[model samples]
Target: MDFEIREDRTAQGRVKLSREREAYSRLMQQGYTNAQACRVVGIDSRTGRKWRNGRSADRRQKAAPPINAVVPPSGPSRYLTEDERLHIADRLREKATIRAIAAELGRSPSTISREVRR
Candidate 1:
């Protein structure tokens, strides 16, 4: 079988394979599927699956973690606090727009929308 060699380039026209691998690994850590992460990283889905399943180019068993794998955060979220939620509720009662509430809380409009939906 012939395998295609793909080179990912940066915005400054620099080829960086390690950076692409890191991006793929990060996407996977974020719960993206192999195909989706491969699309985002500009690589073949087969390559992503191989990395995830810990297989070498010859398809032999080689268990190993991806390079530069980042550990996921395990602490309390730094997002909106209880006070902010209360403020958002008050603003909503006052018929304030989502954008207006977000601006007051220094957050994005989608953040306010998601909070209200919750």
Candidate 2:
């Protein structure tokens, strides 16, 4: 409770809470119940639960992972295909806007612009 826990803790790096978290994990490994570890560590029972199993909309299950808005750049499937490059070439020759070409190709304008640049 003394430690200020912001709701928006995503990737914030809880260096302040790390000591307590480590102690809680140690207690858990030694067969202490969730409540007992929380009491000893001076954090709330719910905070203990979040530290142990993660938060969820449903209290019984772990939190669902965030949905990624974009494809990861590393995969081959994310790359522009030969046909897509040809389409870009054709669209450029016709003087189509980058956004228009991107919309037609189902890609970002940056992708269309980058292809045009190449």
Candidate 3:
């Protein structure tokens, strides 16, 4: 089937190909495979690939954040709060194991043991 690109090639034979890209997008949305859409649009398969998976313009944009980035603390850390202190006190009264309270508070057993020792 001869599919003529209806977009005006007014840019001196270098067609804008926006129409072809649009057609490719539609064909893909309608469940056509990548190669099939490219063939139907009369564009190179590579062109369709570039359209579907766009090229990153800037390499720096993909770089990971700095290692020393100072992200603010989202929760209690470095010190146990008064609530944690109270819980530990109550658990100690009940003769609960250090590991048990640590598991409940999502802290290491050694941390709970050290806190009790302190």
lDDT of 3 at 49: 74
The lDDT, on a scale of 0 to 1, for candidate 3 is 0.73
TM-score of 3: 0.39
Query: How would the candidate models be sorted by TM-score, starting from the highest?
Result: 1, 3, 2
User: Pick by lDDT: which candidate is best?
Assistant: 1
lDDT of 3 by residue, 10-107 (tens): 44232466567667777877789989998888777876776777655575544322113234786559888889989999999999999899988878
Q: List pairs with backbone clashes in candidate 1.
A: none
- In model 3, the Cα lDDT at residue 42 comes to 76
Better of 1 and 2 by lDDT: 1
lDDT of 2 by residue, 2-49 (tens): 433345545534566776777777777778999988887777888777
**What's the TM-score of every candidate structure?**
0.39, 0.37, 0.39
- RMSD, one per candidate, in order: 10.8, 14.4, 12.6
Q: Order of all candidates by lDDT, from best down to worst?
A: 1, 3, 2
Angstrom error at residue 96, model 1: 44
